[model samples]
Target: MKQITVGVDASSESRAAVRWAGAEATRRQQPLHLVHLWLTHGRTAQAIPHEEALLRAAQRLLQEAEADVRARFPGVRVTSELVTADSPDALVTTGGDPAHNDLLVLGSQGLGAVPGYLLGSVGLHTVAHAGCPVALVRGAEDPARLGDGPGPVAIGVSTRPGHEPVLEFAFSTAARYGTPLLAVHAASRHPALIGRDELEHHAAADHDAEQFHETLRPWRDRFPAVHVVEHLSHGSPARAVLDVAPGAGLLVVGRGHHAALGPRIGPVAHAAIHHALCPVVTVPHG
Candidate 1:
């Protein structure tokens, strides 16, 4: 069965991620897999005293994390593994495997200089390279808030094609949680509209709204149970999505793939992961 995979460590942020992933697994009725990595630099045999001690500590941390998840969410089937490899490589390989894992959850330590910025090297690397969807949970967030709150699941809608994965994930999540799906699309102001009349501005907004509705029509049909609220705004897409994120339970954005540059998290997904108040899920799509 596909499981929800989470990276665990001794940090408070990792604990928060465990809680979030545990809650998610319970809700989805799926098993949860906790992973802890001990960087051995490929020296697994005949380790020195300090290295051996560190290995023991890593094992203990994984055990403690597993115990905590089992205690907090008894119904959730929990399993754990200790891997001796590079942190980012191990996490990406384990959690990014589409055959076994459904989602990858990671702890996010917000950049301290900025209030909500949350991309560290490991998170950035994993999110960028992971084959499956990745969810970033902040240390300060309470899992209970996500479990019990009624905040809608917000998604940054793209009119462009090839975003079916993002749409499907957002709609399914909202359906599962029984919450509204706020579909937000921000259109840049057309240069032709410079010094335009009020009537022209209104017409432009109406055009954008129609396009947004057209993009969502198929999803609305597919997820009839989900209540979708269409939100059209002007200016930066990232800023528009962030504005609604403070009140959302979860934010879903698409990770774009560049033919030349390979898989990349776009500005909107980047902003959501770094600064969204709610847990941000970046769904990969080309």
Candidate 2:
């Protein structure tokens, strides 16, 4: 069966991620997998002692993480693994397989000396390339509190096509948690510019509103239990989503279509992962 997989390390952020993933697994009635990666390079015959000590340390960390998850979430079926790798690619590969994994959760750490920012290279790469949805959790968040309360789930709705996955994930999550769903779409023009031409802008906004409603119509019918609040705004999509994020418990954004060169994350997703107050999930589309 598909399981929820998370990357665990020594960082407090990683511990937070484990808690969040454990809660999600309990909610979904799915197994939880914890992965810890360690570098095994520079292990020469002469450095056998050092290598042995490093491996033992990695094993100990993995065991502790597994024990913590098991203690906190006894109902969840938990499994763990320790991989000798140079990077977090093992975790990415394991969680990116849609057939085997439902979602990949990773810890997001702030840049040194930077305030109110997160998402390092590992997060960016995983969010960009993972086939499954990815959730980035920060150290400061209280997973238990967020999981117990009914906070709005906000999603950035794009005017373009191929956002079905994003919508589906957002609606389903809201329905599952019995929380309100905020569908926000932002027009490219500024509010002032829109005001300059009242009639034209009103007509444009009306059209956009209708389009947004139509886009969500099917999802609404599919998830009638979810209470959706449509929001139409002007200016940056990233800013629009961020403005509502503080009140939301979870933020959902879409990873742009894979380019000919490679998969890439959109600006909105990048910003949300780095700065959103709540846990942010990036759903891959197209």
Candidate 3:
């Protein structure tokens, strides 16, 4: 069966990620896989100092993360593994592999030591290429804010087409927590040129509002229990999302997958992940 996977290390940030992932797995009735990755270069006649000790320590960190999750969620199946790779690229590659995981979770930052990573880089690389959704556990200091709460699930609804996955994920999350759903559409204000017609600009804004409301109709029918609020603003999408993030329990955004290679996280997703005050989940949709 597919599972929810989280990168683990010896840091409070990593532990918080595991805690968040544990509650998510329990909610979805899915297994949790705790993964720790280390780099190894082919050794010559001699060995690097404390290399063995570091490897052992990474293994212990994985074990402790697994135990912590198991203790908190006894009914959820938990597994841990320690893998070797060449560089930080391994985290992105391993996370994108569909055979091992369905969802990849990461802490906002690393332990500032060996085997620990600054997830800003990891999140940027992995979410752009991962076949599944990537969730970055960032935000308020209180862990409770992420798990169960009254805050709504805020989503950035793209004015363009092919954003069903983002909408569905946000609505389902809100329904799961029995909270409200906030759908926000951020549109740029029309430029005031030498002969620009103000009437046409207002007409365009109205059209956008209508289309955004229409898009939510099907999702509203599907998740009747979720109370969804529609919001349309004239500003940058990233800035608009950041403004509403403080009142949100989680922020859901889409990562477009169209490139044949390399990271595909667009400017909006990059901004949301880096700036949002709440935990952000990047859903991949083509």
Assess every candidate by TM-score. Answer: 0.92, 0.91, 0.87
Query: Looking at candidate 2, what is the lDDT of residue 38?
Result: 66
Alpha-carbon RMSD of each model: 2.5, 2.7, 3.7
**Candidate 1 local Cα displacement, residue 258, angstroms:** 0.7
What candidate 3 gets wrong by more than 4 Å, as runs, is: 41-47, 110-120, 144-147, 188-197, 258-262
Pairwise TM-score winner, candidates 1 and 2? 1
Off by over 4 Å in 1: 41-49, 114-117, 146-150
Tens-digit lDDT track of model 3 for 119-214: 555456667778777888752346664355546889999867878888888898899888899889886565653266778777878888898888
Looking at model 1, residue 187 earns an lDDT score of 82
Please write out the lDDT profile of model 2 over residues 1-286, one tens digit for every residue.
8999998888988989998998889889999998886655545788776877777887898899899888988999999988676665665787777889899998888545787568766667778888999998888887567346548899999868899999999999998888999989986564565447678777777888898889999999999988889998876898988888888989999998756757888889978888886889999998
- Name the best candidate (by lDDT): 1
Local distance difference test, each candidate: 0.87, 0.84, 0.78
Lowest summed lDDT across 10 adjacent residues in model 2 is found at 188-197
Scored by TM-score, the top model is: 1
Per-residue lDDT of candidate 1, residues 77-105 (tens digit): 99999877755678789988778989999
Residue-level error in angstroms, candidate 1, position 74: 1.4
